[model samples]
Target: MSQDLFKEINHAVLDLQGAQLQTYERPLKRLVSLLQHPDLETYNAELTEGLDLETFLEESARTGGSMVGSQRLLWPDSAEECLGLTFLLLQKMGEDPAYAATFAHDFYYSGSKIIAGIHSLTGQLIIPFIRDYKSYTQSKGSALVALQDVRSRKVFIVHGHDEGAREMVARFLEKIDFEPVILHEQANQGRTVIEKVEKHGDVGFAVVLLTPDDEGSVKGGNLQTRPRQNVLLELGYFIGRLSRDRVCTLKRGELEIPSDFAGVVWEDMDAAGGWKQSLARELNAAGYSIDWNVVMR
Candidate 1:
């Protein structure tokens, strides 16, 4: 039963994945039926009952700006939340067509969250949860389902010689509910530099601080400032590990910017405090829900 349901739901979700405006509703309606199924609600609740809604709702709740005010799609209770309010979105389309119509595509296809041309909907987030629920209910994936709703708030920060910049960024991230991972601050335990980064860097997002700590140029040419060598290396590394969209770069000092990489977002680490909102927008664009209130301050 679970296998059949998973297959059906996955197919419907795939149909919704890259669907165009004209073709979205059919698959979406199918999903509504699948989600509202009696067996599904029961099965999903039993398996997902253990995971807390708070962490799971962190990102989803941020999209409330697009939601129909009366709809309030987030139900703390299980079964509904597991689907990322996808079903409720349909309700919004009907109840408040004028408002919901604007962002309806977000409910079906998540093309905007693409990295290297790969699109994801809420962390692929729903599919994995369903898989975990199936596995856990079967008595096989107890550990996986137990931890699935625990959002990874860790963000990796790579910087060079700018303690002020690092501290400020870390504080801002903390304010917005992310644990910033700064390499030198971690316990060495005899591990090398790369080893430390590898160990403490299982983060979903990476913020690179490109502050000028060195200067160089072609052998005969006048030297131009540059970020430390390690900063560039780690920037490239995280872009590879986490994809370009997941990593953000903050430029400071006099260094020339790195070559533009697709999906990688960069912001001027400015002092007028605009960088906070800028960073917030980038993080939200990458699928993390950012609170404008906190960002505005």
Candidate 2:
């Protein structure tokens, strides 16, 4: 299946050359139209099956066509489909490094304007992929070593009054090459806690410790333990600053989460026995590129 797809992709590359020389606009427009067709989904699925998407994209970028040509290509009518097909082709090219490198070179140099135009029309998509791709390629050989630079990768630790739990989390973060930013430790003399948090807003990610620090009365007049008011505030702040995925909530005990924010996923720190593995997963999902093998060991 991959071989067949590779041949088709090679044919597309050949078509690109012919289209550039002869009737430029028509063939380019037709190719973009064909990519947007629903049938392309099958090809995309077939090509991506059992493939490591990030590695495929990285290899594709490092292989394939010449980096010199500049051709005016037609923008896909559907930006979503165009982006999807682009990713699929990159994955398909991964099966053949020679083809992948050739396609990658052409895509990067010649298709730059086409991608830019797609971004201009769609308003989002492609820029983030490009940034992540660049990061993936740059850290190719020494990912584990790169992760050890705490200064470059900072994780803000939001915790309640549970000193032990917070310390444990901080130590775990440090082991994974993350510089844990504790609010109290880094508080400025004149600034408020909120102000201090804002000061370190550039931190890539945050981990909120939801330890049972405070008791609250429920509708049935039963008292339940919950995180401190400040902890909740900081959690909300991080959620706003760095989306839900980038902010991980680690619950230590039977804590009652707020009704409004009940949908947020919380990992049980006690149940896990060790939080490092789960933390590593969160870091990778949040685009940190953590090599778990080194960190876990």
Candidate 3:
């Protein structure tokens, strides 16, 4: 099969749903077998191009270093599936004599942190890779910066236009020993998107309401027009520093999860104000809250 054919098959496997499990098992298994063929091993690595698994894994083992970093993608899209596929590939690579020893070595020396973002409204998912080498205690480069930024924070609440959700987040904040700032409520007084991001950027937690109204439109009457564009764009800006788990998405009303974020863990707040209480519970458990001294500390 052509490289493109392999990619297409891999992409399809990533999108498999529970309902399609029976149908997907066979094809995915075959694809896995094809990837390991000696003749086909020449294709550059998909995620880390130009580096074969044996070489990368060996370097990771010998140097106690890794190459995984932050990556963004459309959720429910192929990225989420890719995350799972990678693990499978790792295991397959380990079976090969050339890669097995290094795989074992790297597994012992390097810790993996997989971060992914799920947009509740649009369902766009971004996936990033991270690693820590046990031998090299100091971090160097963008990967090191990403690791350093992983600090604990207080609770934060990001609101789009849902007043009730805002109130719920506020109450949740109080429970978590932090104050919640409602952007929608404050923005109603006339603040631009930039101003909102500037003020809330430092907050401990950011909960964006992914309702239809949050998306921006290029023209009037189109479903994709003017709503969460500013908020999402701002969120995208911080992708380099924060892991996906730091962000949570809540959808309200008849809105459905966007194709991109389909792979993320999302909650439905469509009925009976259940979302407010549930979200508060989850955030508290996640230790999300604001700390005035976060930056100072």
Candidate 4:
């Protein structure tokens, strides 16, 4: 499986290398299709597990990195910080390439922030990543993922272009005395989208709105509705970070839901305002102090 997988990857990357910047979409689409294999991602997660912070710090002690400012410490940089992000973006693109323009996401940026510009992702991030990944794929790396247990009162609201639904959820959370954190409303402080998500990982719960803002499908398949790729990207992130119990996806309108998340909780974002009660129930189940009066009102 590994041999066949990388063979496909090698072929894809070889093609990507020969294509011009404007012609990248075809090779990228092929590569995105390859990423849907569960074995490939399982193998990837195993190889990169050691890069997690907890294990990185403790394991670094042997290399004289116990001190904060030690030269041997693995410091943050563009490639290191964007590793997980690029993978997530790839996952989203794989799910629906037609909507991938939101996530084909301009491959790499050299500066402190990932700026909007023309850069060949194939030449930059993918080529280097595959080179490094292949070198390490044969070896298994382990890491201790320290689960964040601090129950926060702040709820992160992940939304798309549905401003009405976004405002409705935010206001309802506020009405119940729960602080709603919206990414667009948050202060940037010059941080990129993914960077802001990394720092704000302490949210107690995530309310993701799967609104139909884009449409896509495979060749010959019917054009189906779906949320923005960024919404799906963040939805996957929160599900992994906070676990299923701490996350709820409010699907608005008729859209495609990822098959992988068939078991995860999902509520219909109806026009009659029934989703508020569903959210309040989820909040209470997660040990939040929810007042029926506020929820009823």
> Residues 14-46, candidate 2, lDDT per residue (tens digit)?
233222222333433433444434644654454
Error of 3 at 22 (Å): 30
Ranking by TM-score: 1, 2, 4, 3
Candidate 2 has an lDDT of 0.57
For TM-score, the strongest prediction is: 1
* Model 1: lDDT to the true structure: 0.62
Candidate 1 or 2, higher lDDT? 1
Candidates in order, TM-scores: namely 0.60, 0.52, 0.37, 0.49
Stretches of candidate 1 off by over 4 Å are: 1-120, 123-150, 258-264
User: Candidate 4: where are CA atoms >4 Å away?
Assistant: 1-150
Specify the highest-lDDT model's number.
4
Model 4 RMSD to the real structure?
Answer: 19.6
What is candidate 1's lDDT per residue for 25-73, written digit by digit as tens?
A: 6665675577557765664554444555444445554655643421122
Please write out the lDDT profile of model 4 over residues 179-274, one tens digit for every residue. 999998778999999889878867878999999999999899999998998998898998877666568889989998778777776999888889
Ranking by lDDT: 4, 1, 2, 3
Q: Weakest 10 consecutive residues, lDDT, candidate 4? A: 109-118
Question: What local lDDT does model 2 show for residue 209?
Answer: 93
Instruction: Give candidate 2 regions above 4 Å deviation.
Output: 1-152
Candidate 3 C-alpha lDDT tens digits along 1-297: 345643543343332211121343343344445445554343323323432434433443454334432112212244323433443444364354234223323332112311111111001111122112100112211222222222224444555566666676566556545566655545434667666656566654556665555443346755643335554564444332333444566766555344555555556765665665555544432333324343122
Q: What is the C-alpha lDDT of each candidate?
A: 0.62, 0.57, 0.40, 0.65
Q: Better model by lDDT, 1 or 4?
A: 4
